[model samples]
Target: MEHSHTADWWKKSTVYQVYPKSFKDTTGSGEGDIRGLIEKLDYLQGLGIDIIWLQPVYVSPQNDNGYDVADYCEINPEYGTMADFDELAAEVRRRNMHLMLDIVVNHSSTEHRWFQEAKQSRNNPYRDYYIWKDPAPGGGVPNNWQSKFGGPAWQYDEATGQYFLTLFDKTQADLNWENPAVREEVVKLMTFWAEKGVSGFRLDVINLISKDQNFPDDDGSARPGDGRKFYTDGPRVHEYMKELNRRIFKPYNLVTVGEMSSTSLENCILYSNPEQNELSMTFNFHHLKVDYPNGQKWELMPYDFEQLKSLLSRWQTGMQEGCGWNALFFNNHDQPRALSRFTDDSEYRVESAKLLATTLHGLQGTPYVFQGEEIGLPNPKWNGIEEMRDVESHNIYRILQEQGKSPEEAFNIIRERSRDNSRTPMLWDSTPNAGFTSGTPWIKVDERYPEINVERQLHDPDSVYHHYKKLIGLRKKHQILIDGTFVRLDEAHPQVFAYSRVKGQEAVVVVSNFSKEQTVFQFADAFAEEWLEAGPAELLAGNTKQVPPLWKEMALSPFASYMWLIRRK
Candidate 1:
């Protein structure tokens, strides 16, 4: 459980995720690239961001928008050359910030040289690098595995007369980690990035790295295609992660976070145990799964505040001491905006957005701020399914159509839940293409850029941008906010979510209104006595409140939030 490195550094760090394709396009080639990100380092630094987690810029066929890697060692020509990445890494370091690169080792593009070699013949040396098997007696797949993108997970390779494993698209073949050679190659490839000055790696679908060797088929009663339980969080996952840490990450003092899907709390603690010498942290999907119908594929579900609060609290408490850090996020390259998903964005967008930010960032974990989130960006109102670019969105649309859902219904779901929601061009200014590019953007920019762009908000003191700035600064300036213990207050209050972070004598109480209507609540007697009237600095809202409570209850405006520093009476 003991960490060789200091914990304080990570406790106070704020990571910013940049989806390269949508961040900024400098080449005017309709895509954002390394050069474009390099140009924006100053702007990110100005926003008080401490680390940059750049999503995949590696060579890919773009089947899954860069998740399918063709070459781990080379940069995609469309993104830029290796020289540009080196410069970007150096530039970020110059600002005294860190950079984390996406490591997609779970799978590779079917067109990759290794896959191509494997496809030629079963006897090829490269054949073992991927999982391949002959068809069943019935001339069907080896198992009832389902691809995350939809359809069967096993893709038939006619030339070899076998099927290769692909948990995602057919173009992305899952790697066989049982092969020692593959593990060695992954370590070497990771070392290549470490040597290039990448501070860390955000491992992609890392839990899927070690699959169930038995390759069991889904039961007859299983859903159309649900094999995740069999392949996810497999037996050798921890062993593989530990070996990776010992061989590559530990030696370099690198920060590594695993993008683990279907991982339970037990697995999270095991994989991220500081003493396990594995990952620095592992992301939790419990909150994200709230909208999934019985974890079934393509089911309409709604976000639940109580479910989210329980998930966050569990992670915060479960990983309190020796357990590795938790990576906190609401929106990423694959998620819709937090405002739209977590709040009632239709009427209380700004208040709910800021309240959500406060509620999340105030928790005990490493917070990740996705681009445009600071300005309270909501999911774009895409007119039709044709306007979306994400493959998952397209696949879901087709699935909905087959399930008898109307085109309008399909498009509506896509608009509200598509990964494309996060990929919309950055709203830097009110100019053409949201100031992301002069030429046409690779994807359509959100229409609300004129009011939501960074340029306008940066100058306005009351803007969400400035609110985030203060939040970041508060975390940095106050130890209680950064490295304190969390205690949930008024757990049964449906309209209120409150918690206090205490470090010895220093305490900061944070309370948020989760509903659209005002709520009245009183502080715990112990906290009320020591409460200091630190006039509301407006962390997210302009709402103010008087401190101390004995005979009266404090009221919070609709979707309002408050944080106050309290000392011992």
Candidate 2:
């Protein structure tokens, strides 16, 4: 199917995600604030970023690191005041860059006014704003469902003697989408930001907004008994998304991406297909789970090369065939850094990081650059649980211990898979606190900041940051990168991830060696006869300074990556 979103600026743009807590701290508050981000607008623009995707800065009670928003309309004191936010929005526009806000409406922190008042009495007007149910006849939780973060999905309200659903942390009460009032509230909050010049909305766990009204128990089919099947891509999810688009996005002409949890490819296509009018793109975690043994995130294994290649190819082809868009990324606030997870941090950090950039950037999707990702940052080396501050990590660590894992064993897993791996402070310079804050940082900065800081990379032309910049720039220069039909090259190639994007006479070919050993790739019969003829092709980008010309048989060095643009002459 031919996609028609070519005219959309977002289609050709790159997004830079800034986790406010660890980005930078100008106020010595020990946490990053709006003003701190404002100070980095030039830095972002210099990196050729087209949009800035800022994580939630809404009022919260320090739960889920601001994902559990207590107030959607107000800026968190820890982040900054509304005035600071306004300055940020204005500064973003001044630089000709768009700002995308993270919208967390699936659940509200228990400290929110609606949830607080709802707890006051069952008859409170705000009671229906959240999901609540009567205790089971056996006087336990409402169902056998478990929270995504471990523990029962329902928390008994002592005052009301009823159970409330919390798909995540107990402090985060799932919003009741069955109530029109709640939906309206969400629209109002989004409109509030749109009115203030926010051009994009990154909806967190958006697919989970519509849950099954029946509140059924898990049948042991879904993994971990999370009851995700009942709510994930639920019966009314499409309707809810359509309603949201009609009320907020369509009117404002804003770009939107839905974070889909445990979602399927078919559901994602419907959610992001332009004709569906639901979302501009969707973020799915299937590829990121290649290392999850048996799809369990708490457990870890060496990433399956075959699975990673297959998943990427499937999503690329599936989304293209369905005219859907993807929000391409490897590292995000909730994920561990891709460098550490995919390649050896000691030997091939820079090359593999660039290899990953070229591999994903050449695909038909909008790429997102997590703050430290462009600088080739890897997972922090934590001494113990004390240095790791992620709430989920702490919870998982304790659970692993209860399951009979020794502290050392559990810590190793946590060290590798903890969300804190990506949440570490952005390394700006090698000075104290990695130049993130003058005061003691809320969390310890990664010890490798001295070598990986942006300052060091900025001056080096061969740095990973420059490689990302070149890859991003190519997206704008080559329309094939955005609108071309995706075709995976040598789908079963053991050590190399390769693909080609074709659009009429022009094609962008990308190849990356995912292994430390050298690998040779042979062009397919069709591609070799059509494009690999003895002709001149522009080498658009490569991880190494010296790259060989295109040929029928290509040899890729360890962690090597190259993107070539060819046209019928």
Candidate 3:
């Protein structure tokens, strides 16, 4: 497993994901822009971020919030111009940091040139660029595939008298990867950015590109169907990924991470394994779905802690054994702030935030910190459906009511589990509009911004922001943390989440109390005896004001977390 200069840097680096729309509004447009991000570069660098993973700022119809890219080569006028992007790339390099752009190649917005031309006529040269099929013998949709948002996955094009595949929104047409021209077009666009000095790419839904050409109908057994099985991690996904690597990634020495949706652990390993020449890392949503009762996202229930522990342990151990890398994250643009979902965010907001940080940063992967997560931003409070901006949340609210749920019942579920929760304006100060905008904001700022803004936390010594800073710095200070063997500690422990990362003689043990009450942590029998009787350990980072006793058996306060650097006797 030899490493190149580019390969070694990503392993030791931490990425900060910015949802450009809600990050900062510079022109009083109520939308974040490239200039606004430029103004905050110093703030991000102060937090010790190595790479800035900017979410889609490409030209789009905003159907899926920029996930449906209309033009891969042009910057959205809503965000800024191409010159602003060039300045951002140059500024990022000036600060000795890298910029990673989010790329959506799995599908293209209906307004994209290719899709527009394809819809003009069946014999159009660009028609083969997207997947289009004739009606089934029954004279309906080409297949029984269902849309992820709602309704049918295939949208009928009257002009062509055919239906096109769209697993997500109908406005987003799936690209035909079987066509070499389509694959070549993707490579060309990605290379365009690479030539502009972009260091990496966060590929969105990349696993679904090389879908089954057979276009088979799905059985009704799977919960998330109309036909995810046929497309997710499809037959030629690995082959396509390998080709991508050879075409651009390897030659340009760019860092790439694939956003895998409804994918398997085995597929992820092959997708990210260095030996496989596919990608640098992968993002899986298994652990995040612990609250999805019976794999249903709309329903609500207490998240299964045991299930969370098992899934994390499985991936940690499995990825480590397979020599594959993972992109570790919790809060993101598409999900609610994890603090609200995992623990008590009311009484112990700061403590629980730090605890979640320790739990993730100590794992074996490149940690991605979403905007405002560093300052302990929880989910926003919404009043009604009018305040909601996410299309998925609105669609689900209607579906819940269609399922016979009362208005109150449906809204309650949406309030708890809406993507809009994380899309609120980033709180920079305690001023009006949370200092995010001077004009009317696209979305309302959370009322709690006055208390949880970054200005207040910046001066506080014991703040979530500083905790994340120290954790990011620790990776550079300790080599063991970069490539340690992940060992789960006491999987049966009900109240605490713990693990150890060992490399040769040194190991870093991370212990976190996930419960509200104080708990005791006893070393599991599987732990090596040498570590228990080891010499005095150094406290690496922790959430508590005062350090706890360094011993095999110790008391852990509510939401208490600590990382200890140890050397086996």
Candidate 4:
């Protein structure tokens, strides 16, 4: 525990994630632009954001909301031009904050010139750029692999007589990483952005880039998309990553965080360990999977709290012990708003928001705050099927119906799990369009915008926004918060999640009530009486200013959280 994460830039810095299109719009275009981000620099800096990890703003077909990139070096017209991006990067630098761009190298939009040419003929030079295979024996698709979006992973091209792999959407053709030329091209694209002043890269679905050379069927899997097992941590993943590090990232001294979907702890260590020099950090999605039951994301199921605790503890301990860094996040452009997913967003919105912040930020990782998360935004009412825009949501709905479920059942499930829940326009004020745009927003602003908007909360000290600012400041001021060892407490408590970050004699115990009912946290015999000196612990932060006597136990109001500094003699 003596070794610390104090000196590293990411270890102590708070990163703010911006989902470009829905974040803010200035051109009456109903979409957020790079210029809009430039205008909001002061607002982001005021929130103590040391870095901004912008979601993909690259030129794309809008098939997956900027994820399916058609051009890597240019900015999307919806987001503005390359010159506008330059201005935004300069503004971020002027504010003393770093800019991290989303790098979508796992696949490219079919509209990309390379993919277009690859579809022309089997002998085409661009054919090897994508994963293409001959038809099966019976004149069907190339393999039994299923797409993450829906149906088959293979898309047939009439012109070429071969099926190309599209792990995500049919329009997104997977790249053949086994081809050294393809790898070199990807590195070139990334280098182009780095030379443009980008500080970091958030590699999208990074683990999926390396696939099993021998295409095989996921026969035993009940679901179709079980194909992930083949590519989760493939044969050449580490080799490819190491090469990428040596060629692209290490040269710029840039930080990189790979978004890993189905990665193992052992491999994660190799991917992010500082000694390995592969990545600065890796985003493990296991914590976010607690809500998926039987491995089905569309199923309506309550989050398994115990499963969540165990998974998080494993990652926290495994990564730290393995000399690897962790990237911690609750909400993202791809997930539902955390306030509504984990807590009662209606009644205890403020308290639960603060509690979640206290719990996640106190851990040993580089915390990422999704856009609007600081203001405690909740998922908008799942208006109707027409409002849903994501291909994944629509695909899941159809799949559920094919599995013998009623249309209502499928709609309800997709309503709760759709990416559109988080894609709603940001609520900046009580204005008609939440001040995001003078024109109509791409997605309707949440109706509660009047109550939870930023304009009103910016001046309120007790707002969720202010609470986050305090948490970020605490991490910067208290070195222990960034370098302490994690110790879980009240493991069996259904309503309270508690832990302590200890470093030598200095420690901070974090306690949060996860339920709506009042609860009491008693000092376990070993925690207070046996280990610490007999004295009052200094309160560092809490939703409620009042701290009850902790001689034996302390009462916690519904959703209340506390961070106490305990120094043992």
Candidate 5:
């Protein structure tokens, strides 16, 4: 493990994620554009972020909102021409900030040239580009696998009389990575972007590229309509990543991160460990899925605090022991807003938001702040299903209604779990459309934008945005936040989540009240002993950003957090 003085830039830097479609829309086309992002680089730099992760803006049919790449080498016209992207790259580098793009390689849009040719005839040279199989004995899909969007995972092509694999939308046919030609193509695309001066790539569903050759049927015990067990972290995923990293990424000094969904910890270690030579880090979805009972995304339940603690602690200790690094994040384009999902956004929005930021940033990993998370954005109580634009949300709503659920129940479900909640236009100001676009937005902007937005919070002395800035500043000034060992304290504590980062004789203690109720500050080792009496100590940060009182016999208010630094000789 590299220490702070010698660690790579990414090890000590923070990343800010931008869901391009909702970041800004400069064209008045009701959609975000690359130029709009270029216009906002200053705002991100002001927040002290080192890298920006832009979602896919490649040419596409928008079936899966840019995940279905129709052309790998070109930018979508809605975003702008390739020249616009080149300009953005130049500007980002001039400011000493790196840029990362999402690479959706597991699948391609049906309209892609290769998929089009593959579907033309069975003997076509491109036929091997994607997975294809003949119909079953009874003229049904090849397997019982279900697409993530809805319906069967296989889409029957009338012209070819074969079913093509589409784990996502029917428009996106899964690529056959076993084909040397397909692997070469993916590698060539990676090289193409790297040559263009892109510093990093976020591989989407990369762990699912390989598959079980037998195409066996699932036992139906997975998530509602999931066939992921057969392909997730499949046989040759690590091998392919090793080859990719050795040839293209490592040479270019590019940081590579894979979006590992439904993956195992063992596989994740190999994926990100430097000794394994696969990826720099991975975005694991396990902790984020704790709220989904039985692995079903549509079915919502109150997030389990203990389950969250268990998963986070396991990954934290596991990855460290395995010589792998993690990418810490709470919200992204695919999940509901963080403050609303994990905290009481109504009464404790600001404090809980800061507490969440403090807890995650205090850990030993590269922290990622999703766009607008610093402002304490909450999930919208979207009026009805019709107001939702996310394909997954609409699909689950339809499925729930077909499963005999009442309209009210289905709408409530969508309200609680829709990805649309995070895709709303960035709340910039109090104006209409939240100052995102003068034209209509692709989706409804959150109604609370007037009260909670960048303009309102950027200047507020005690806003979530400034609090996040303080956390970022602290990480920049302290070495322990990056290189120290982590030990979870008070394993059985119910309400207070406590942990310590220790380096030599000095340590930093982070304690957060995870619930919206007053709680006694009792943990494995209170500050009264080694911290208050046996060593020199000082309060580094708190929800109030003040050392207002003594540490002993203090009642932590709802969503309160405090960090103390201790030094011993």
Candidate 6:
């Protein structure tokens, strides 16, 4: 196969995220692995995905699933051996698809030999690999810094009478990237993977890799005594990323993306600038955080269409030439189903799902399809908190309970916003455990699998799967959708979200109705003379009519959307 390095491949390509543990299980062990993924290569290719970003499958104790790595060079026995991974990589190459793996260098499992050796004594050679410090005079934590999952970020160890930093759970200790030896080890690990034919890496919590050495305590306001600033986008983040890129990523032609939590637009531009060899792109959470509560806990904060449109438009236009690419997505392993979160699930789930798909894929970025997203899967409804399996969910549930929140309130919050919402077993068929596993699954399958499995949708031409196929096809066939300049239309229109993609002579207009009520949008006069009836422009959903006098007003039903190709005479 000929290798293409024109930098245009990513611009025109589609990426799919595969959560290994939930994708498929071939061993009847109830856990998905690399071998299972190899078995589904044809399915992925058929879906038109150009890249597969697999979550962590490294050797670990399974504390934070696979995020806590025990050994960077070895594959977990439960997933498969190195031979199975090589086979998977070969299959990806055979299909001309890129294979990307998650890089969890920000932290390592406490069980990692390095961490174990560091914990043994302060004088150990590996002691500098992890962040360790002496306790303050009061013998309390190093500071009032709080873990993202909750509680103090520092955990005390009796052996050395010191504290170790863990931004997530105690079992996952943050690495001290300030040390040159640690940076060298990480670069070596990345090279080891790249040499095995891996094309890229999806960095995990990459922004948190650098920290404010001062370790200042929170002013008792932002986090209620928890210091988050010290841990977010610290002083040397870009420097560290540049070093990693120059040492390992650049030489291999690897496309790298960083999960930059709490990243600002300015910071994102710096991290993703094509000139800066830091990262190929960074996943921005600006739009995703709209519904989040003001403080820390998960609360019901409704979304406004105007605000969403503005946020997306700013990001789209701001990333014109020098800015790095965007990772466009609506749902992922940590997010709830897009159909449930962004649309009205009670009545217009299908239409809304289609609209969401069009809106994401039509943008100027690389679109990522999460497992089961193409079929418009709805969020699972857990009967009780005990049924949830995600660590974040369990931690939030405990925190709510301690705060004297009622069972109803706590359950409602989690049901609306749990990471487990996207972690449910993939609905492959109506069989036991959604055909994801022959035996019981590690996590419970969504109960609606009987009505929403892949088997049924694959047969229905009007299913969400087919709509995704059409949208992806449109993106590939039209240069306007891939590299066009985005222009927002009708900014203040409450019921309508309109945008036009223009690339010289080629232009495509997209209009979406976010509300359940019908909406009528009048096209601007500039498009009147050039507006030729381009067939019933692929209606994502609802009714449309071409009125006379060059006026095209569409009556979009609840959660409806449409795409029209405009041509000049």
The candidate maximizing lDDT is 3
The true-structure Cα RMSD of candidate 1 reads 3.0
Candidate 5 on 278-373: residue-level lDDT in tens?
A: 998988988888898877778879988888878888888888889888989999998998788888888888888888998898887889999989
How many backbone collisions does model 6 have? 0
lDDT of 3 by residue, 154-229 (tens): 9998888999999899999999999999999999998899999899999999999987888887877785456888
Candidates' C-alpha lDDT: 0.82, 0.90, 0.91, 0.85, 0.86, 0.82
Better of 3 and 6 by lDDT: 3
Per-residue lDDT tens digits for candidate 1, residues 1-569, read 22233743666878999999999999788889899999989989988998899999888889988999888999999989999998998898888888999999899998799998998888999999999989998998999888888789998888789999999898999999999999999999999998888878999989998888888887745565588877789878889998998898878777778888878888888877787778888897878877777765356677667877777877887877656578888878888887888777778887777787888878877789998888898988888877888888888898898899998887877787888888888899988888899888888998888888989988988777877777887777777776788787766688888887878766667888888787788767765554434223223323234432322267777887767666554
Off by over 4 Å in 3: 1-6, 525-528
Error at 93, model 6, angstroms: 0.8
Which 10 consecutive positions of candidate 1 have the poorest summed lDDT? 534-543
Each prediction's TM-score against the native? 0.94, 0.98, 0.98, 0.96, 0.96, 0.94
Better of 2 and 3 by lDDT: 3
The alpha-carbon lDDT assigned to residue 308 of candidate 4 equals 79
Clashes of 2: 0
What TM-score should be assigned to candidate 5? 0.96
Which tens-of-lDDT digit does each residue in 1-569 have in candidate 2?
A: 11134436799999999999999999998899899999999999999998899998998997888889988899988888999999999999888889999999999999999999999999999999998899899888888899988989999999999999999998999999999999999999998999999998999999998888888888887555669889899989999999998988888888899999989999999999999989999999999999998888888799999998899889999999999999999989889889989886878888988888888898889999999989999888889999988889999999999999999999999999998988888999999899999999998898888888999999999999998989888888888888999888876888988888999988888888888998898889888888877357899889886797788898888999998988888
Model 4 stretches with alpha carbons more than 4 Å out:
1-7, 221-225, 530-535
Error of 2 at 498 (Å): 1.1
Distance from true location, Cα of 272 in model 1, Å: 1.7
Candidate rank order under TM-score? 3, 2, 4, 5, 6, 1
lDDT of 4 by residue, 238-309 (tens): 888899899988787777899988788998899999888799898998888889988778787899887877
lDDT of 2: 0.90
lDDT of candidate 6 over 7-110, digit per residue (tens): 54677778889999999999999889889899889988887888899999999988788999999999999899999999999999999899999999999999
